[model samples]
Target chain A: MDVLTTPLTAFSQYFSKSDYVLALPMILLTVFALGILMIDLMLPEEWKRLNALTALIGLGFSAAAVFRIHSLLGPEVSCIPGFFGTVVMDRFAVYFFYLFLVGAAVAVLMSVKYLEIERENHGEYYALILFSVIGMMAMACGYDIIMLFIGLELMALSTYVLVGFLRRDQRSNEAALKYLILGAFSSGIFAYGLSLFYGLTGSTNLGTIAQGLEKRISANPNDPVVIFALLAVSTGLLFKIAAVPFHQWAPDAYEGAPTAITGFMSVAVKSAAWALLLRMFLFGFYPLRALYVPMLIFVALATLTGGNLAAITQTNTKRLLAYSSIAHVGYMLLGLIASDGTSNTTGIKGIMFYLLVYTFMNLGAFAVIASLRRREIIGDDLDDLAGLYKKAPVEAVLMLIFLLSLAGIPPLAGFYGKYFIFLSLVETGHFALAGIAVLYAVVGLYYYLKMANAMFMREETTAEPVKSSPSMSLALAICAIGTIGIGLFPNVFIELVNWSMSGANAATIAQLMH
Target chain B: MMPVATTFFFYFLSIIAVVSAIVVITRKSPVHSALALITTLLSLAGLYLMLYAPFVAAVQIVLYAGGIMVLFLFVIMLVNLEKAQLEERFNKQWQVALIAVLTLGALLIFIFEKGRSVFPQTVTNFPENTNTQVIGLLLYRDYLMPFELASLLLLVAIVGAVVMAKKRV
Candidate 1:
């Protein structure tokens, strides 16, 4: 009895009320996910769409909680380290939380009709999305490597299942298999790197690991252990973002998955990886910036060139978007490379802004493809998009907006994503990389115009009208509005990005103690 | 200096682990491969025990050598082994794979050789009797978040497995 009481007291000391408050968003999502699973059993087939509504409600609640936390903490005290620093609720985490919730909510909206068309409508789909949203939230807030890794696995596992959700489709099965195998391989490499870091630093906390890395760097400036660990970790993250050399899995996975899932994967999953990458590099591996920067430049160049070149040949719409998403990763990497060490966070801000904007435009583009799905036709080929304007004028116009934005056409939101990244690059004086990035942008413009040409110019092939469900239209409207709104009125969103970045810099951890 | 018996046993177990791991991959027969994998896992458990992590050793034996091996054997038995044996054992890109493997091996060797000095000669020792207790405390308290999140991971895996394996959802 004495032993049990002593251990219980010690365990109780590890948590507090604030910790639960800090984790309310994840808790709410988990509870909702479980609730959906439980309620799924009693629902009739006609009411299956209710699962999507529940998921959206869960995302809304999570977003409100994040907003409350953000408002309460404000800009001055940005970082709130909880659970003994395993997680942190900072401006960065808050910003990404909203981004992820929006991505998931929009995805849930898109998934309802798409899953029904696929004849795979089930509560598990919405529950899985919520679970993945929780994972993304965790990834955003994870202050410890263990937390980050678990979050990554949770997100990866859910996405893998979602990718293969269409049980009857052979392509879907193939895609999920390729994604699972490659993803598992990369995770192994990632774990190896993490274990090495733990062995070298004797700590899993990012803050402590940064300190340990600094000491190790001073002792041996060119230690191969540190280099190997950096390479391995970056490799794993690169695979997630679909960067070149490790991007072979992307086109297959994207092409094979359900259209809504492909959209979700392109936005939410990629953003979570971006969040993890930024946190790990900016917080834990900042000392090795000099080494990683050069490596990133080469990879970014390859990714840009490879992604654009590959997109030109893809007749399949999903495959084309996959390559384009990889190209977008190149631009984001440029932003990361240009982060001015400890002082200026212009590049980091640029990345956050770009991810936010990309979520809208990219998801909008995919939502259009999802809207085109009918009983007879899958509507994924460039030819399937022929005469979209003649059929569904609103969706066609909306898609035009998304494609133009994606291509970095000025006065559009997509241009601002590129603008911020290029601005950061120039600010840090990476003119060569910036110039190369511009060249790829032109190549990107060509393929995007190709898609637009198919929609507005090509003769109508299929006689069947497009299937634009209400939920899908709402998703498209949200995305289109976000894309146009950000493009036309960039100042407000720019200020938000600035505010998030100011509180998320290297000084964030220092302010945590107070 | 390490005791001769302990060092010898360490090297012996390591050799067995390495050899059996190679055999596990290289074997043509599925049953033989599974048996070799068991040998590898057992040797790894022995090595873990030598490192004074008795709990990890026990888990390795119970989970890998015992439980997973049964699953592996079942899978091997269920699959059409004769037809699998007749199929091409290697893909057409074996040459490319060989080159890639060699390059990776060389890189790893170079890294290990260069970073050898950074590794400490001795590891910090925990009280062997209290190893499990300390780990339990860490898992439940300091690592409470990840521990809880791991349940979510397992749930996702379970759901994913069911979704993939079930005939209909």
Candidate 2:
């Protein structure tokens, strides 16, 4: 017994408890998704909401794991290397993991009633969302290019199907097909760039890639491969984030998708893509800052104007939100542009805070829109929401909160998100760009106010009262609280965001100097 | 072993690859284009073999030529191409796209020629040994994470195929 146990113990030592904790959220999600699929097969039609309950429980467990791991992360971004350094558990990744969990939970809550209303309530919906979360978790934590690409695919493929879930609806099918084609093309471009990066560095782990890139750049100042890699990777990622020139599919997809799914895409997908972009550039392409910064500046200006100007023309609320989301991507890019590729805490912090605020504000707005949608109504137009104040006072009030926040009015979550980015831009001496962004933001206010006015002033077209479910209300309450909580008590969130980025900035600066 | 033979084969492969690629773009019939693509892929695989990358050659044939080509043809058959052909052959913005592409091509050529010295020109030193053992060891040890992640990607693809393609489910 002693002889047999000795070898087993040796093998077990190769794996550790930290590995389990580092990957806890992804593990919980995958298991629950599979478990739901199995149980869904056995359950009767009346027990459909049971799948939503299981998904919620799964999300809860993952959220609990995130909290447990939260204390382990120090103020300094501590990288707990697991799986041969492919998965780096850091404060930055932890922040996003928490975001993904909260977003998934809200989506689940919204899905329960939304699916029931549409009569397409099934277990697959919950399972696919969980699968997408698993992908997001992977994207957040992955330190290697392969891990990141696979995660991106997992997320994209699942969402593509989720978009076309309503097979009977022609608009949904059209949007899904368009998304799939463009998404796959961008992925190919991304893979080509990644392969070139691998060829030059002879490695895929971002830390080593950065080290290799640093050496290569120092050896030859104008390495053409460096410029090409930047073009390829940035283009691929920009498409995913719905930035300009590559954002054509976003409005159609967002307008056509299930409202909860639209919210999920707006929040979860944006967060994951931005995280990957930060990791790649801040860590991997820091040496070529001069080459990439100008590219980002042009992109930021284009995205800001394109998204806002297009959004102004949209009469459909969902399409308007879609373009608005693109515009928000432009603001977030300002944060990236201001980052000195070193210890620029304000820049990364601003981006992180904005994403967090956005998850709540955007999801809250979408949740209200989902609640309004009925079979006969299909009420996504501005007219449908007319005089919402009279029909559902509470919903109208919640929508107003979201609109004001989005409009960047003071004492709301959205304002702070924009304020931080603007501060960072000003601090970096990009005063002119900051001025332009503010001007566009003012233009953005008009459309948002138009919708707010529709909700408040116009008379209702129909006689019946607007309604909602307990689950939808619960989701809305969480979002409303998140929106107000971060806006009012800025100290706590700012401190946390500052700490999360503390490790990455100092480490990046130190790595370069050596 | 013969320099002349190698040169002749290189030219043969290049002609096949380029010709087939042009056919793939220009052919009106989808099936003909797909078949042309398979030929192009196979010729590229031959070039890989000539470069002493037997393993890559095998994969190019198996995955791209065999697996992906089948999928491409399946999709082409599924769609109604006759109706598609009746529509406009080119986009309204084709002139703009063409100019951008031409400019990009010129810039790429200039960069390659000017920066030729910076780019490493590695000597052809193919290992006499096979790659099977090397890749296997690397996959099992050094690239364990990516290796497993590949499986997860396939699983997602399977799920997507079912969820999107199947009508009854």
Candidate 3:
């Protein structure tokens, strides 16, 4: 038998040219992370800040590789499968890849000073973030459930250490343990779901699974195995995104983890999970939409209500933002519910646009918190933020802009993101759900403004002036511009998302035609 | 193929596994519990081999029984032994957890009933150790991406272990 005696086959059989070229980004990221680890050992303590630049350069190189792949694939939306079709360099992946890079860049910028403030400024921090971004890009590019699982584990494992990276703090240790326990449980459940899907379809490839499920569902509409798979898979991902019922770990984790890692979890992790969810629904579970959609509807409603109501009771600013993040997941799920996975631009584009908008808004908010979080003072309390206007005028104003945008004010990026989702929902005739989403958004605004009101309206609590480094300010500036720019000129970003997803929409249309 | 000896061995393994699992929970000393856990794991591996999955059985014995259980014992010993013994046996919410578990078990039975059409009772015969070759080829070929990505996860775990246990950042 060839298996017993033959030498390995040539690489050409399993890998296309794109596998090597498109893979350059992840390869370089890994090299950079390892290089930083080695370099950190040799560098004198005084020169440790150089790791940030090294990380930025690595990110820049990988982003440029993404662009090169984009040009190679051309403007026509196409899925250029590689790594034996387990991964694809498609416009959908490219979109998320770019967003992840942008989020990583901003997070690194925010961390530069904050790490020094907390006295945990190690090169491994930057290396870990880069590694986490690689996992996210893998999830975005994954066309196989196994690929997605590995990607999720890579991201989740890196983040667990990153959360507890503040080893000296007991709160950080507790948060890390809780997150690890809950996260591992969810991963187990997720794997169980994937196993069931594999058993039912006898395939792991998304395309093959889709084909198999469509035939099976046509014969038996209420397939218990498929419904259970949907429940298990969604539960696992919803935990990642910090949606309701599975969200117990989030508030404490967000409040305990170093501020920058919290922002990373809120943005990069959320986007990666959403990307996987979208892929699963659009591909493997397409025939069971009727089965899965009701589940999502119930989840979205509960998440919105629980997130806003619990947020209203939180005194810790970090905890409030945690709840707010949950509420945002609810809004994004609406877009998924509205889309039928055909050549529909509105729903997918809305989710993409909202994720991008959320990156700027959420990162900007955390940057303000980081600015105030110096050694000996963990200033993430609503009371501490009171009179923030007097302590740091620029931060206060930027926080106001960010919070208002998060609250979905007109002419801001968040409003457009929500509006697009609402538009899609109306088009899909989910008028009641659309109305509930809006009402919840209004309720969410109240809590968001409480932060703003405390900052601008309350008297000073301390005489301390919030000190922020140039790099942190630069991150804030980028976020502020994005929040305002996308808000003011919404069409540019919306059009870009539509163009990138054109390839995905085409793929979906072909699948529907089957 | 339907040997009485094999059937007798299967039931023996199942009974041992259930009894050891119960002992694992009931034991007062963590060391005793960990020992019981190893017995449970070894019996489960025997069950897997009897089900024609020799590779899985080997992995179960090697990873769970040998590697993980040792680690578990080490942790139980390393932690404050006196304080752990003094703490409550169960949490305040054990009753709620028990009720929830029972409900879940009932729901699973309902699901099994609903999907009974596909839950075939017969088991297929396979050539000895063929699953090893089949799984190896699958992992190395079509699932190569995830296979490699799994290595990345392990690397992350290693990094996490070092970062968490290290004295200084």
The lDDT for every candidate, in the order shown, is: 0.88, 0.84, 0.85
User: Candidates' DockQ values?
Assistant: 0.51, 0.33, 0.43
By DockQ rank, best first, the candidates go 1, 3, 2
lDDT of 3 by residue, A1-514 (tens): 2221111122355554556776888888988988888898888877888999999999999999888777665554366667766886778888999889999999999998888877888888898898898899889989888888889889988998899988888999999999999999999999998888887777777877888788888988997777888788888888888888889999999999999889988998889988888888887788888898888888889999999999999999999999999999999988998986574558778898899999999999998998888767898899889999988899999999999999999978889989889999998889999999999999989999999999999998887778889999999999999999999998889878877778777665454344
Backbone clash total for model 1 is 0
Candidate 1 Cα errors over 4 Å, as ranges:
A1-13, A506-514, B1-52, B57-66, B69-116
lDDT of 1 by residue, B1-169 (tens): 5533387898999999999988977778888989999999999988888878889999999999999999998998899999877766568998999999999999999978876677644466788789988898789878888999999999988988888899977
Off by over 4 Å in 2: A1-17, A75-77, A219-221, A341-343, A510-514, B1-118, B121-130
Residue clash pairs of candidate 2: A77-A503
Ranking by lDDT: 1, 3, 2
What's the fnat for candidate 2, on a 0 to 1 scale? 0.41
So what's the TM-score on candidate 1? Answer: 0.87
Best by DockQ: 1
The interface root-mean-square deviations, each candidate in sequence, come to 1.5, 2.4, 2.5
Shares of reference contacts reproduced by the candidates, in order, are 0.64, 0.41, 0.64
Please give, for residues A93-155, the per-residue lDDT of candidate 1 as tens digits.
888998899999999999889888889988998999999988888899998999999999999
Instruction: Estimate, for each residue in A1-514, the C-alpha lDDT of model 2 and write its tens digit.
Output: 1221111122232446666676788788888988988898899988999999999999999888887777666543355567666777667788898888889899989988888777777788899999888888888878889888988888888899888877777888998999999999999999999988887777887877788888888987778787798799999999999999899999999988888999999998889888888877887777778788899999999999999999999999999999999999999999999976454667778899999999999999999998898767777898989989988999999999998898899899999899999999988999999999999999999999999989998998877566788999999999999999988998888887877787566556554453
- Model 3, clash count? 0
lDDT score for residue A199 of model 3? 76
Name the best candidate (by TM-score).
Answer: 1
